[model samples]
Target: MNLNATLFAQLVVFFILAWFTMKFVWPPIMKALDERATKIAEGLAAAERGRQSLDLASKHSAETLREGKEKVAEVIAQAEKRALQIIEDAKLQAKSEADKVVAGAKAEIEQEAARVKESLRERVAELAVAGAEKILRREVDVKAHADMLAAIKQDL
Candidate 1:
């Protein structure tokens, strides 16, 4: 056999086999690779979406926590105000009670003072009657007796 002829035959067979592989085998392999690449791209996109959703949830939770803190502060402030109001009310009530007690004490003191004055007045009237009887029984001088009665009247 001639070497040139054998080489030429082998070259023709190689071209036909390459053509068959390109037409029948390469397209399916390329399609499968393209489908796999598309699936990978979709998976990456879904992962990115999930990450964004997680970030949004974190931000929402932080905002909700801030709102809850504000509400708690508001409740605490209201409670403090209510407590102050209750204390003020108690103070006013205590002051009012003290005033009532003072007024009652004053009234009692005035009644006691009036009773003492009445007793003093009765004692003075009895002394005047006794002095007048002694002056009449002793027959003292008219001017002196009259002066004694005047002194007793002044005491009364």
Candidate 2:
């Protein structure tokens, strides 16, 4: 065989094979690679979105916890304030009760004093009557001052 002729035939055969492969095989391979790359990009985007969602949820939970703690503190402060008000009200009520008791006691003391004074007046009147009777009985100038003695006794 002639070397130039053989080499030229081989070159022609190589061109045909290359052209067939480029037309038929290379397109599908490139398409498959593009599809795979797109799928990989979509998966990475989904993973990023999931991570952001998780972070958002965690922040929301922390905010809710903070709000709950604030509400609890507010409730405790209100309870303390109410307790102080109750204590003050109780003190006032107790003072009023004590005043009422003192007033009642003073009234009782006054009534007792009035009763004692009335009894003393009655005793003094009885003593004075007895002394006058004794004086009149002891003075016995019989008929001479009988009329005057009678008048004095009647005045007594």
Question: lDDT of each structure?
Answer: 0.86, 0.83
Q: What are the per-residue Cα lDDT tens digits for candidate 2 across 29-51?
A: 99999999999999999999999
RMSD of each: 7.6, 8.1
Enumerate residue pairs that collide in model 1. none
Per-residue lDDT of 154 in model 2: 52
Tens digits of per-residue lDDT, candidate 1, 7-107, equal 88899999999999999999999999999999999999999999999999999999999999999999999999999999999999999999999999999
lDDT of 2: 0.83
| Residue 31 CA displacement from its true place in model 1, Å | 9.9
Tell me the lDDT of model 2 at 21: 100
**Cα deviation in Å at residue 109, candidate 2?**
1.8
TM-score of model 1 vs. true structure: 0.50
Top-lDDT candidate index: 1
